[model samples]
Target: MAEVVEISDPGDPRLADYRDLRDVELRKHLEAEHGLFLAEGAKVVRRAVEAGHDARSFLMAPRWLDGLADVLERSDGPCFVLSEEMIEQVTGFHVHRGALASLRRQQLPPVDDVLAGARSVLVLEDIVDHTNVGAIFRSGAALGFDAVLLAPRCADPLYRRSIKVGMGAVFSTPWTRLPDWYDALPELSRRGFTTVALTLSEDSVPIEEAVAGVGRLALVLGSEGHGLSPRWEASADRRAIIPMAAGIDSLNVAAATAVACYAAARR
Candidate 1:
């Protein structure tokens, strides 16, 4: 069972894991160094624990205790109870859900492991936005994509903002980064999955036609500003584009993923 400890000082060393969450680079380095990630809100916190992540500690206002009582009771870690103001001071932002948890990150499974038995998967190429990564995971999970694959440069799906935006979908989805970005698509092809690259290339066909009759498929999406690299575009078995009205050439990566996943699910 967890022990509840009341803390008034924002700078207490015990609260170090919960500090300066708004500082992206600092938080990235800190979290990576400690092999931990933060889960915000009661729901995401509970999801993280339920997904088998061990909690290092929990920080919350007194009022949030009851709502998360079951979680705290199940956890053997310490729970720091603080005033809302103190939490805001430590975290550098108002914690609207009034709860935050630092959970240990597990070793990511290899790409082959994540791809085992997967029929439909989403491949992300250099998507740097945590929010977009999270949204893509949520959409892929909801639409029945069996797994997700990320390029070496993609954002961390377990990052706090990504996890929050994904509503913990990152925990449920099977994913891992490709070891070799250059051969990612071809490797998937060798594993019996058709590679469909979503882009605006000259040879691109409609999304539905591109994915049709593919028993196993890997739908690849690119970065925010630039789409897929020329090597990836040319290497794909089929290039696909989502038809749009005038003045709208493309959708945001997340929006595009949702649309493509929906189509892939129905195909």
Candidate 2:
């Protein structure tokens, strides 16, 4: 079982990592310098445990410990037991789920390794919203996509709000952030994967036609409001659009992802 330590003082150095409820700088610093990601709520903490993330510490209400006893038993780290009021004070918000963990981030395998045996993959470009990212993961997992890739501006999948929004699917899905979007498409084609960009351009073929011919495929989804930029049209092997009602121009990015994922899986 993980050792449960009682903490009351907000200024205690032992709780340095968990202190300051609204310290965005601190969170980013921890991620950039320490390579730790925050996993919040019972659901995400459970997922992180199941995914084998190296847990460093837990901050939670004393009563919440019982709910995580099994997870705690497997966690080889300190669990800080605080009162509900103390937790609120520590986090600067009401964390209704009552448990949060700090986990060491694991290194992802090379993109080739991720795509080696995969038939379908989703590539996201500059998806800045955490909610959208989470929704996409839920849809991707349910629709049977093999893995997900994020472009540089995509929100961190391990962010607390994203974990909650994704219902822990972020941990279940295989994901890695690709630094260079320009090289990704060509590299994927060289690996025997056709690249399909999701857009509503005039030249775009119906999604069914694009899905019909591809074997190993990378389905690219762009930012929610802007859609795919002009440069991607020439780079991708095919452009696809989901047909909608007479008046409806397009679905939300997350909704489009669900539809695209379903189409890709059937291919």
Q: Estimate each model's TM-score.
A: 0.98, 0.92
Model 2 score (lDDT): 0.82
- Model 1 alpha-carbon drift over 4 Å, by segment: none
List per-prediction Cα lDDT, in the order shown.
0.93, 0.82
lDDT of 1 at 20: 94
Question: For model 1, what is the error of residue 87's alpha carbon versus the real structure, in angstroms, after optimal superposition?
Answer: 0.4
lDDT of 2 at 267: 78
Model 1 lDDT tens row, 1-267: 789999988999999999899999999999999999999999999999999899999999999999899999999999999999999999999999999999999998998899889999999998999999999999999999999998999999999999999999999989888989998899989999999999998999989999998999999999998989999999999999999887976899899889999999989
**Runs in model 2 lying further than 4 Å from the true structure:** 19-26
Q: What does the lDDT read for residue 97 in candidate 2?
A: 85
What RMSD, rounded to one decimal, does every model reach? 0.9, 1.9
Q: Write the per-residue lDDT of candidate 2 for residues 1-267, one digit (tens) a residue.
A: 678999887555666566553576677676768787778888789898888998889988877888899999998889998888887877788888889888888887677666667888888887877888888888888888878888777777776667778888878877887868777777777878898999987779878888996888899888877887676656888999998889986899988889888887887
Judge candidate 1 at residue 247 and give its lDDT.
94
